[model samples]
Target: MRRTSARSRISRALAVATAVAAVAGLTAYQGVAAEPAARTLAAGSPEGYGAGTTGGAGGPTVTVTSADAFIDAAASDGPLQIQVNGTIQLDDMEKVTSNKTIVGTGTRGRITGGGLNVSKASNVIIQNLTFSGSDDDAINVQYSTRVWIDHNDISDAYDGACDVKRASDGVTVSWNHFHDQDKNALLGHSDDNGSEDRGKLHVSYHHNWFDATTQRNPRVRFGNPVHVYNNYYYNNSGYGVASTEEAGVLVEGNYFENVKDPYHLGEADSGPGSLVARNNQLVNSGSGQTGGSVSTPSYSYRLDPAANVKSIVTSGSGVGHV
Candidate 1:
């Protein structure tokens, strides 16, 4: 979020001055202070930070109001944190570069009528933002790795709200709210693009609130083992999670209320995949099919109870309050 106004700048300056003065006083009195604690990703979240991800670590924040500037800030060399204050409308696709953390300031921060392209980027984290009316995908990631998308509200996109494809690996999508959308999310691009997609696209999708989304609460493709867990689904018109085109998915501990299709192994014409469904709660909904089993993920995550998913997700999912 940008401090563009004079009042905002003055307020920030005064706040910084007060903080510096207080810190100096405390240091002088105590003679020394404790070392800062090391930062970690949110607990039980399995986003890879082993060798390829450091999203905006120890970098200055660059606040902007336009989509072009946001992309420019992300495209810079070093890790950077980019904040968008108000809604930014775009006429073209904005490409987010590598090693960036893009966060919205508050409830009013949003991206409208545009799309974010996270192609070939690594260590990117996008959170606390609202995306709507996008001419294309609200957020598209291809050939990327170690990305985390959390606490966002995405709706009414022209294409899929969030699509990850082209061998993207080690990603986590958590605590997002999806409503009034169609083709919500997609894992792989196509069935024919199998070679590039093989043995890639490992992701964790958890704690999301999907309300009335039409379909593709992530339709998956080949060589992807997506873990879908502890999500809340309300009155969904289409399927909840589809594991198609040889894709493997583990659907577990989800709450489905009045949804038509809670989970399925494959699409209408797509090749059959594998899914393991367990501990799901269904109320006035269909418990979808399970064909085979998928291999377990290489990471660990704590799963919330399916019976309490509605309460847990409703109280914490989406932007502005994170």
Candidate 2:
């Protein structure tokens, strides 16, 4: 059941804050520190296909508060960690190059009006940012590899909050709060691009809070073993995860509340795919459709119990919470 009381929510938030403060020498997201830490994947590192993603680690950290400065830093050459300190209003979809870590500072970092384009790049990280009013996708990854997107709050984008397509591989989208948006995350752009996307587009979607989002809590295609696990879904108007165009998805250990259509094998104009659902907890939600055999994820990671997913995700997802 959903914890609707304000007192309960405050207690949970306070408990989470206390736990974060106990971790020593980690980063701002974990505890208070004199200097910001370098870019690193939190805790157990990225699981599933993005297991080895390490973005902009061992690089000089540069803080950017203006749009021009952020854009310049994002497109600069070599490995760099760009720390966003305030709202950066962008004019268009800004291009980000390889070996970059773009992270928000505390809860003040915000990206508005435009979005990020990770095109043909590799080893990039985007974390702890608030993305809204995007003219395009809040984060678009195309032809990229080994990218990790974590701990972001995304909403109000004209296009998808995050869209990964065009043969991107080894990507992880985790611990994000996606709400107040129509289209959410998507994988594999087109039905005709199977030639380029047949063996690619492998992604992991885990531990995210899909709160009242309409649809596409990723509508996927051509990604085998797309791992969707330990996520919390609440009051989504449209369906949750869609595995279309012969993709294979594993929906496991999730907590779904008031989502009528949770997971399915196909979407509009797309043929049936393969899906496996296991150990999911549904409250006032339908038992999602499933069929065919899905390849097991090769990476090893611990799974949080489905009963605790609401508290776990709500406490840890979005900016400033890491």
Cα lDDT listed for each candidate:
0.76, 0.84
Lowest lDDT 10-residue stretch of candidate 2: 26-35
Candidate 2 overall lDDT versus native: 0.84
Among all candidates shown, the one with the greatest TM-score: 2
Q: lDDT tens digits, residues 1-322, model 2?
A: 2212322332333334334543433222211121223434333466767777767765555566667667766776676667788899998999999988888888988999999999999999899899999988999999999999999999999999999999999999999999999999999999999999998888999999999999999999999989999999999999999999989999999999999999998899999899999999999999999999999887887899999999999999988886
Model 1, runs deviating above 4 Å: 1-53
lDDT of 1 by residue, 202-244 (tens): 8888889998898888799985468888999998887898999
Worst 10 residues of 1 by lDDT: 27-36
Model 2 regions lying over 4 Å from their true place:
1-44
Question: TM-score for every candidate vs. truth?
Answer: 0.84, 0.87
Residue pairs in collision within model 1: none
Query: Pairing residues by index, what is the TM-score of model 2?
Result: 0.87
